[model samples]
Target: MATNLDLQEQEQIDAVKAFWGQYGNLITWTVTLVLVAFAGWNGWNWWQRDQAAKASVMFDEMDQAVQAADADKAGRVFKDLKDRFGRTVYAQQAGLLAAKVQTDKGQADAAIASLTWVADEASDEDYRSLAHLRLAGLLLDKQDYDGALKQLDAVKSSEFAGLADDRRGDVLAAQGKPAEAVAAWKKGWDALSDKLDYRRIVEAKLTAAGAQPAASGAAQ
Candidate 1:
């Protein structure tokens, strides 16, 4: 009985050895890769958090500059944010804020540069649309009718459809196309949500452009 048990144990040991020999490298590598990937994922998350925190500080500085109405300071801080934390949302926000201050300060070129960066590089589509809208307005102010139209064309977000139409009306009017302007203004007037007070402004624009206002129910 003892000899038989020993033979059975030896057979079991041999089976295990054979299996290990066949799959040892693959199993070892698989486990190593899983552990490495888990560690890398944790490290990546930590890095992102660290980056965001630093970017937040810079954003606050930019905000302060904007509030103070110091266009030069806002532009400088915005440049730093773009250089060091360009991938962060804070950087995108800074660009927009900096553009606003620059525009207010009559630094049209600086505003254009900042808006262009946000329009091109922002990860969020909403921000890109916002940037494009502002850029279109700036281009319109500069009398770059074609460039304004091009910028308006870049804004494809549904949320900005009314704004785009309104901007198009302005561009067309600037190009001496009053008939087209009136049509564009009507579209913008109709596209706006009834809940928005801004729709009244659009209605006024339509009236000014020689387009009769739509019926109240139809406008709503």
Candidate 2:
């Protein structure tokens, strides 16, 4: 009986070895691939965190420049942010901040460049809309009516659609098209939410354009 048990154990060991010999290479390669993919995923997450940490420092410098009203310093820091971490959220925020300082300093061209970059490259839809709206305003100031209209047409966020239409009305009015302006303002007023204070401003503009809104919460 003991001799039979020993032979059975030996046969079981041989079966396991035979099975491994047939599939061992495939199992090894599969495990290797899974480990490499996991390592790569971890590396990618670490790299993004490192980038955000570095970019945040640069963004702070740009913000300080904006608060100081120093266009030159803001421009320098923005250039660095673009060169190093343009895809980061901090870099996009810095672009908006720097553009504000540049616009306030009468550097319209610089502001345009910054806003255009943000409009084109920002991953956030709202940032792109804000950039497009601000760019349209700058073009309107320059009396580039066609360019202003083009920027307004690119606004992507539904949240800003009302503001874009309002700006469009401004552009149309500036082009001596009061009828079109009034139509645009009416569209804007209807798009805005009654709870928003900005909706009252749109309502006012609509009324001033000789197109009084049939419903307005401005009195409320």
Candidate 3:
């Protein structure tokens, strides 16, 4: 009986060896590939974290420059942030800060340039929209009616639709197109929710534009 048990154990060992001989290389290669992929993924995550950490430090410097009311220093720091870390939110925020300082310094053209860059190149859609809106306002202040309208027209957020239309109306009014302004304001009014207090301001604008509001059933 001991001899028979020894023979069976030997046969089991032989079967396992035969299976390994047929598939061992394939299994080893598959495991190697999976491990390499996992290592690469981990390496990429570490690289991204390192990059963001460095970018954030630079952004802090830019913020300090702005807070100190040093327009030139802020501008230089922001330019570096833009060049090095344009994909970072910090870079986009630096642009806004730089633009504000430039505007306060009466550097309208520089402010517009900074804002235009953010509007065109920000990775975040909301940041891009904000840049466009602010730039449009600046252009309107400069009486660049067509340019302002173009900027306002580029806004794509549904939540911004009413405000963009309202700004468009303001620009049109500035250009002596009161009829078109009224029409734009009406569209903005229609797009706004009834519960929004801002809609009353739109109503006032329409009234001032000599466009009578539609009669409310309650008023009737």
Candidate 4:
């Protein structure tokens, strides 16, 4: 009985060894790939965190330059931010700040350049809309009516619908299209909530443009 048990144990050991010999390399390779992939994922996340931290510091420097009203310094720092971390939110915010300072310094071309970059390259839709709005204003100031309209056309977010309509009215009014301007202002007024004080301003615009607010349209 002891010899028979020993033989059975030896047979079990041989079966395990045979199975391992057939598939051992494949199992080893599969485990190696999984481990490498996990390590790579961890490394990528670590790299992004480090990149964001460094970008935040540079953004602060750009903000300080903007606060000082130093357009050149702000532009320089903004260039660094764009070159190194243009995909980051901090870089997009820095672009807006740098553009404002440039505008304040009478650098319309520089401001337009910065705004264009933000409009074209920002990943965030809200930032892109803001860039478009500001760019349209700048173009309108330069008497580029068509350019202003084109910028406004790119702003399609519902959150910015009211402002975009209002800006469209302004541009149309500047182009001497009173009828279109009034229509645009009516849309803007209707888009705003009744509780907002800004709704009153939109209503005033509509009144000035020979249009009645929806609430008063029936009375007229």
Candidate 5:
């Protein structure tokens, strides 16, 4: 019986070895590919973290320059951040801040240039929408009605739908299109929540444009 058992075990070992011999290379290669892919994913994550860390430090420097009211220094740092990490949220935020500083210093053209860059190049949709809104407002202040309307039209976020509509209404009103202004304000009002105090402002705009507000219950 022991001899029989020994022979059976030997046969089983041989069967396993034969199976492995037929498929060992494929299994090894499959495992190697999986491991390499996992390692590459980890490496990419590490690289992104390192890049974000460096970009964050530069953003803080830009903020400090802004707080100090040093426009030249802020502009220099912001330009560096944008050139090096334009895809970073911090870089986009710095651009907005720098544009505000430039505007406050009577640099409307420079402010528009900065805002235009962010509006066109920001990786974040929300940031791009914000840049377009601000840029449109600046252009409207300069009475560039067509340019303002174009900028407002470029805003892409549904969340900014109300603001964009309201801004568009303002532009249309300025251009003596009261009927279009009222229609835009109505759309904006309908998008806003009933509880929002801002809705009242839109209602007032519609009223001023010789348009009647929808019934209070109709503002869905």
Candidate 6:
């Protein structure tokens, strides 16, 4: 019985060795890859958090500059944020805030530069739409009708479609294309949700432009 038991144990050991021989490298490689991926994920998360924290500090600095109404300082801090932490949310916020300061300070060129960066580089679609919309308005103020229309054309978010068409109408009107303006305004009015008071404002524009407004049930 002892000899029989020894033989059975040896057979079991040999079976395990055969299995290991066939799958050992695959198992080893899979485990090694899993560990490396886990480590890389953790490292990437840590790096992102570190970057955001530093970017937040710079954003705060830009905010202070904006509050002071110091366009120069805001622009400077925004440049630093763009250079060092441009991929962070704080950097996008800084660009928008600094642009606002620059606009208010009559620094149109600086405002345009900051807004252009946000329009081109903002990761969030909503932010990109916002930047493009604001940039359109700035271009309009400069009487760059073609540039304004181009920016409005670049707005991709459906959420901003009504606003974009409204701005497009404004640009067309400024360019002495009253008929085109009316058409654009009609689209804007049709796109806006009835719940929005701004929709009514667009409706008024349509009426004043001697165009009939599209009928819609009033928001309950």
Task: Judging by TM-score against the true structure, name the best candidate.
Answer: 1
Local distance difference test, each candidate: 0.91, 0.91, 0.87, 0.90, 0.87, 0.92
Per-residue lDDT tens digits for candidate 2, residues 53-120, read 99998888987897799999998999899889988998888888889999999999999999998999
Q: Which stretches of candidate 2 lie over 4 Å from their true place?
A: 1-25, 216-220
Q: Over the stretch 12-115, how does candidate 1's per-residue lDDT look in tens digits?
A: 99999999999999999999999999999999999889989999998988889988999999999999998998989999999999999999999999999999
Rank candidates, TM-score, best first.
Answer: 1, 6, 2, 4, 5, 3
Write down the TM-score of every candidate.
0.90, 0.86, 0.74, 0.82, 0.77, 0.88
Residue 97's lDDT within candidate 3 is 90
Model 2 global lDDT (CA atoms, 0 to 1): 0.91
How far is 30's C-alpha from truth in model 4 (Å)?
4.1
Model 3 CA lDDT for position 89: 84
Model 4 scores a TM of 0.82
Candidate 4: which stretches are off by over 4 Å?
1-30, 215-220
Off by over 4 Å in 5: 1-22, 142-144, 193-204, 212-220
Residue-by-residue lDDT tens digits, candidate 3, 3-64: 99999999999999999999999999999999999999999888878778988999889888
Q: Candidates ranked by lDDT, best first? A: 6, 1, 2, 4, 3, 5
On TM-score, who's better, 3 or 5?
Answer: 5
Highest lDDT among the candidates is held by which one? Answer: 6
lDDT (C-alpha) at residue 8 in model 2: 100
Segments of candidate 3 deviating more than 4 angstroms: 1-37, 190-203, 212-220
lDDT (Cα, tens digit) per residue for candidate 4, span 65-86: 9879999999999899999998
Native-to-model Cα distance after best TM-score fit, residue 5 in candidate 3, in Å: 14
